[model samples]
Target: MPFTLYMLALAVFAQGTSEFMLSGLIPDIAADLQVSIPAAGALTSAFAAGMVVGAPLMALLSRRWPRRRALLVFLIVFLLVHVVGAVTTDFGVLLATRVVAALANAGFLAVALATAAAMAAPGATGRATSVLLGGTTLACIVGVPAGAVLGQEWGWRSAFWAVAAVSVPAVIAIMASVPGGPAGAGARGAGGELRALRRPRLLVALLLGALVNGATFCTFTYLAPLVTGVTGFGAAGVPVVLALFGLGSFVGVTAGGRLADRRPRPLLAVGGAALLVGWVVFALTAGNAAATVVLVLVQGTLSFAVGSTLIAQVLYAAVEAPTLGGGFATAALNVGAAAGPWWGGVALAAGFGYRAPLWVSALLVAVALAVGGAAEGVRVRRRAAGGAGEAPAPAR
Candidate 1:
């Protein structure tokens, strides 16, 4: 592990903290802004929407820039956005700040992952990406809890301010550690990158990414309610349970990285299957508190554990276009994050049982597995056909 990877990892930590701290502070924000909880929740949605919209836009624009320079610029923008978010008075101003912050976040992450891989040893890309992504998982485990405590003691504004403060050291470290060079000369240039993206196999991989994430989040968005309401936990216990879920995610991401390095395809298949099992367990055990707790841990673990493998799959699927392909995969994940909660909310409004979201999520996971299987089959068939054509040409 290069020292710079750790620096890049710190930048990711700051961005992840900013993105997730909102969930813990939403109630505080609702109270301070004189808005309903649902309205405050929209702030999170706004951020996700911005990420989905801004990632590709930023990637395309920065396609010609050095990866290190791109990372620095994005982090600076992210820091500024957080400062604006901390001080904004009106709900509309806060919303705008959130959007800009999310844009910076999306750009920063997309570039950072690429930079990490660039700096890593050959065959260490999976571990490198995992290390950077572990920052996000760590944010859930450490940052969110700290932010929640800060929000409770100080105020919601304090949480945002705290995140901004963290970014100071991150920006400094990023500047000192990451190197700058000309872009698009890495492995392949922009034209070659774009050409690789045109492959059908890569598109199939992105579709699979979008589906898996969308379904996982659909179940996750309502986890607190299901825990408290259906599982018969008190409000006070919900946070504790959620904290456990976060810890599970932290473990999952790290473990998944190791397994992915060993076996990418089978690990992904196992992850998808585990997610399906989690949903089924959640649906079946919602009325049993002990079982529900166990299932929630699995749910969070499976949802996040496959993150590294998924990125590896996407990059491999589009190895011809590493940076752009990874960026698009991340953008798809953000799209799912934004859409999934909305989908779950609809299920709730339709008077579905508390466990309905889990069942629906299970159904989507099954679909994702089927799509992945189809994509893999396509790759194998194409390889076989190429071999056959080569045999005949050699004979001729």
Candidate 2:
């Protein structure tokens, strides 16, 4: 509920836009740089790979730094990289900038999550995290499309320039609003945080979170092809359907935030099952354009409602880890984000129909549920023996 949380959310909006906007700029970048589209697309992969590696590493390196300082430094570096990316004439320079920018993005997001959750009162961490995530979803709805339009009208470089400019206000907000204390001040140092990873319950939750996200993204990455080719929606209608999905995601985040801290297991159980069912139904109904449209919104809502819960689940599950907890959340999601697309591409290349990703998504969600159920079984036995297993891993 703090205004500072909103500012943190603003900071992530800038970062999230940078991540997704590259999809729109790929064609322009490839043509301008005299490279193949696939080569230009590598910029997106570089960013994902950077986030995947950088989140935990940056969080660890800055674990001792003041939270405000860490966030500000990341924002500055992010802004500078975008400026360099916009001005550079060489493809290699641009690629380097993407990786550096992603490093900054990951570091900032890691700290921001910790900062937001720490700022929130007890029982409100889920709402706080969702507030922050809402900004990222907003970027999907607004920022990515605007970047594409800017690239179309001006140049792809202009889109980069726009991203840099957007960060200026966010940087100012964080500098002015964010306090200078380290998150979880005086907690056990990085060693205690590292030890959190050894907990079986925490590890299972992280894997569950990863699988749910992998399912969400594997379907998301392939939605365009499925909508256009199988549903016969036509290329011009793609944005409309994608926008609907984005709106559904925003709604899901809002709803999930209110309920996640209250009863996460039931939430995950019901939502994950619904998501799995939705994916299967979508695959079967791909030939029906009207049904396909309805399913996009349904799938988006179910996927994010469950996915957002897992984000909160992981953060709480790694409570001893604090700042590292935030990094863990980011890293887990990006791992899925990276793998989903790679695996989806492989399916398509292997001659699986456009509908194949829906089935793939279903399998990922089913596995996540099975894993969650197993973890729940272990949790019950531990609780029955003694009340020792209820600290951070309680309820979820």
Candidate 3:
């Protein structure tokens, strides 16, 4: 909750807008670039791949640099990439820009998360994490909607300009607010730190995190076209639909943060189960305009509520590996981010229609819930054999 954290969040909002606004612009991008909608949707996957691959690479390469300087350099790269993206005519060039911008975004996010944690007043790292993540949640509300409207009024290229424009203010804030100190105490040896990935709990947490988000992007990535084409809402209604989802997301993260620390297992299991049911209901009733609209709000709330809590579980599970924790959790979510759109696109290409992704989403949620159940079952059996009342596991 520091002012500097807020500034970092502001910067994240700028980059995150570029990261997420493409969802709303998929149709326009496909039309302008003369590609199929599925091809256009792959851009989301490319960006996510960049995040998954680049966060750790960049973190390792820049480990010795001053925090403030690294942030500015990353933001500048981000801004330039958006500019390149705005002017590019070829889909290939635009696609490259998405990957590059995501790399820069990932680098900045990794650094900012470290900075936020380093600055937090003892045991408040979770709040700091939430404060930083709040930027992306906010981006979904303000920046993503504005991008859709801009794409509607002017063109999809203008949304890229908006991302670049927003970066200027964030750049100013980083220069003024962040300290010039080093990233943190130098990280421990590679083998010692790398061992954190071996934990069964961490691995499960990572997989569940990925599945939860995959379920979401399966439906969300194509919302623009889905609402316009399948639900009988006009193209102009796309942004409103997105805004409702964003509003629900805002509610979700707020509620999840309050309960996750105290009741993570129940929260993710029940919330994900609820989302599974919601997706089924949504697919069955999507033809009804009123039901579709109401379901968007309900599904959005359930998805983010569980999604946010699962992320927290991954973070807690990886507490021993400070350096790798953020990158791994990030990779987990972006794995879903990359996979969801590609699979959703596959369904579309195979003649499954817009509703196919909903079924895919429901299946992903069920898989995650089953994994959680099996893990819990093993833990229960082990505890009973070990003679009850064992100290609770670190991540639970």
**lDDT (CA) per prediction:** 0.75, 0.85, 0.79
What TM-score goes with each of the models? Answer: 0.92, 0.97, 0.85
Tens-digit per-residue lDDT, 291-395, candidate 2:
988998888888878888888877777777777878878998899888877777788989999998888888888888888777777667788998566322335
The residue pairs that clash in candidate 3, if any, are none
- List where candidate 2 sits over 4 angstroms from the true fold: 390-396
The segments of candidate 1 whose C-alpha lies over 4 angstroms from its true place after superposition are 34-38, 187-191, 387-396
Candidate number with the higher TM-score (1 or 3): 1
Q: Model 2: which ten-residue window has the lowest total lDDT?
A: 387-396
Q: Model 1 residue 11 lDDT? A: 74
Q: Per-residue lDDT tens digits of candidate 1, residues 45-135?
A: 8888888988877766676788778887888888887778788778888988889888888877777767766776766677787788888
Better of 2 and 3 by TM-score: 2
lDDT of 2: 0.85
TM-score of 2: 0.97
Ranked by TM-score from best down, the candidates are: 2, 1, 3
Question: Which has the higher TM-score value, candidate number 1 or candidate number 2?
Answer: 2
What TM-score should be assigned to candidate 3?
0.85
Question: RMSD per prediction, one decimal?
Answer: 4.0, 1.5, 3.4
Candidate 1 clashes between residue pairs 3 or more apart in a chain or in different chains? none
